[model samples]
Target: MSSNTIIEVKNLNLTKGRKKILDIEYFSLEEGEAVALIGPNGAGKSTFMQVLMLLQRPTGGELFFKGDRVDWKKPIAYRRRMAMVFQEPLLLDTTVYHNVASGLKLRGFKVDTIPARVNEWLGRLGISHLAGRQARYLSGGESQRVSLARALVLEPEVLFLDEPFVALDVPTRAALTAELARILRDTRITSVFVTHDYSEVPLLAETVTVLEQGRIIQQASPREIMTRPTSRTVASLVGVENMIPGKVVGTQDGVVFVQAGPHRIKSIAAVPVGTNVLILLRPEDIRIFKGVSRHGDNSFGGKVSELLPHNYLYKAVIDCGFPLIAFVNPEQVMGGEVLADNEITVQFSPDKVHLIGQYD
Candidate 1:
């Protein structure tokens, strides 16, 4: 392990009830870096986190902490250095202050030192005013804040969040995510975050690890993971909405041109000519045009097959050779002009298109 590596794993394997769960060859977490562990249902995301948190021992392989093999003889000494918050608050049936202070008190902190630490975390998580309130009486948002205070009060060297925001309302989740982001930045605590919601990954993690079927498929920065998926399965897992079958026709000046049905798409990627590929387009990157601008390589005329109001924008399916899903802000471009069966041009920047792995 490198000097900065905080948690490292090698040949890790886990089995439960004769079923294999995790088979990680190698993985590492650097100090002060946050990683988003994400996958679809039954991808063993939780099993992997549980192993790293030391809540579940692996069936085989070694787990290293700060370059030293973990000493299982003294489990509390290692476990105490980390904290975990789950989807539910899991608060004790007690006062908010007592709930936050419970961990420290159990760990043998001096009675005099507990209040300052508990109160400090309460203030940091914005639940200080509810310090005296009973845990059960608090709202979901407040209860989660109390839970966070409970975990943060430990001053843990590493933090594990297992979908901690999953149970909160949308507004509450957003607010708490922002708050957590600030705290993570300030503290620089090594963190492992697991969430099924891909949207939440950007809010918490700097690196994104994509796992699937008891194995890690890819690990990279969020942009790279979204823009350049390692396989078609990964593309589907990451919500790649528009995947058009195409073949690479030519390459020049750092761009590859492909023929998707009648449309010729240009993407800023590298691939050998004549290579079969899937052109991945994000819904947000699709641009709607009222008329044929005829700009260049990325424009295609398609009929508006359907349109639906999605929040402040419109979700549209345009029959442009392929049924392409597009999002347009009606308030900005065509407030009253959009309707089904109307002819419109669908276009996107050449740079927005991404090519997946070479086709079989």
Candidate 2:
């Protein structure tokens, strides 16, 4: 473990009834750094967080905190230094103030000093008005805010949140996400946030770690995880809807030409000629024009095979001898130019293409 690393695990393993649940080779969280753990369902994101918080005991592996090996048998001291929030509020049946003050009281905080600390966090989380409300009577958002206050009032060295905002409504989730981001920045408390929603990763964490089938698949900045996913699973999780198999044909002026099915695509990758590669394009990166015209490089004509409404955008599958997915906004959809079986021109810049070498 490094001097600044607050937590580290080596060869971590977890099992239940002869079935392996987590098998991470190594993982670490640096002090004061916010990191997000993301993956699909059954990816062990919550298991990893539970293990880090000492809520779940790993069947095997070494865990270290603050450059010292952790004693699994006596983890109370470490647990005291950390706090966790879950998807469910899991609040106490008492008033919000008492729920927020429970941890401090258990930690033997002086009676006189507890109220100020509790109130500060309640106010900071924008739940002071709900402080006296019964926990069960509060709305989902209010309960979650109380849960956050309960965790943050302890002022833990490490905070572990396992999809804390997943249960709230969209507008509530968005508002709380922004508030939590600002609070995390201000507090500078090291945190490990686990969520399946990759979109929330950029807002909450500076680094994103993708776990798949009990192992770490990729660890990178949010931008890199979105634009240059290292594996097909990560690609799909990050919304890279277009993954085309192609071979590098040639290079000119720093742009590599790729023959993807019947279309020749331009990319800024440096793969050797004749090597098979996977052309990864985010749906948002592919631009759909009203008609066939050379807008720039990598422009071609395609018919919209399918157009489906996805949230606030439209997901279009274009067939230009190869199936390609693109996301267009509602305005573009309302423009009456893009529709099912409509002939449209597809174009994407060379720099927008990400290539992964395909050994198969």
Candidate 3:
């Protein structure tokens, strides 16, 4: 690797029982940067992570670390520089301190250094108070923290996490995420995380790779992947609720006009004239007004068809010829008039509408 590139996979392919599990043409990770591998279940995210962890060998292609070719026969030597955490905590039936210190013991660290290192990691993971607890008796969140301490205590150059927070409650998940972010920032360790949750991408990664059917469909920054997805599958994976089929009418100046059903929408994106396209809009970007709004370029009269409550907002599905979901504050809907069949206008700025090229 150059000073910038830490891990590089070129034309990697993996197979199990004659079925190809992963086919990545080109992928690279930069030093000290965090990347998220996101996709639906059975998309090969876990299989790819396993390959990187040296638990599985690729059926074809090349993998390099720090510009050195990986030697499969000597995998154990190379694997010491990396550590991984899985969905569940697999703690040994021993004290929390010994579990965190196990890796060091295997590496033949001095007895005097193991306790200090274990204590350091426990404090770092905010589980110092649980150091004396039996590993088998810890709660889910505490066990995950101990598992994290065990991984981080080794000071590996690269870290792999496969849905590490999947089993924790919401508050515990958020707190662990914040703590992991701080540790990664301070340590500057190159990291790869696999997750199916779209919301976790924005919090954990600077770059995201969208995988589908064992292939990388799109890779970009979180903002770019969300706003300018290259394919409809990528758009749906990022929680884009509005993906209306449209035909690009024309482009004038710097704007593109598209026709969806009977509605005309102005887009900041440029597409060739007469080309079929998919217009992607997040529910949070759509605004609802009781009457006409002077701000947005595309506006249509609609009737509120349904109001569904999500975690912290109300998702209102409106029938404006074309259906759309708008997220509004729950407090704003309190004691408000029932929206059923109520006349309303759904509007969105031209910049918020993304035009994705039609993929066959």
Top model number, TM-score: 2
**Residue-by-residue lDDT tens digits, candidate 1, 1-360:** 789998999999998898889999999999999999988889999999998988888889999998889866666778988998998998999999999999999889999999999989988988888999999999999988888888889988789999998888889988999999999989998899998778777768899998888899999998888877878767777777888889999988998989988878889987889888888888898877776557566988998889888767888888988899888787633665556887888778988888875462
TM-score of each model, paired residue for residue: 0.96, 0.97, 0.96
Report every candidate's CA lDDT: 0.87, 0.92, 0.87
Q: For model 1, what is the error of residue 20's alpha carbon versus the real structure, in angstroms, after optimal superposition? A: 1.9
Candidate 2 vs candidate 3: the lDDT winner is 2
lDDT per residue for candidate 2 within 1-360, as digits (tens), equals 678999999999999999889999989999999999999899998888889999899999999999889998899999999998999999999999999999999999999999999999988988888888899999999999999999999999999998999888899999999999999999999999988777788889999999988999999999999998988889989989888999999999899999998989999987899999999999989899997787888999999999999988999999999999999888877998899988999999999999997642
Give the candidate number with the greatest lDDT.
Answer: 2
Cα displacement (Å) at residue 287, model 1: 1.0
Better of 1 and 2 by TM-score: 2
Ranking by TM-score: 2, 3, 1
Misplaced by over 4 Å in model 3 are 292-294, 335-338
- Cα displacement (Å) at residue 164, model 2: 0.8
Model 2 off-target regions past 4 Å? none
Instruction: Assess candidate 1 and give its TM-score to the true structure.
Output: 0.96
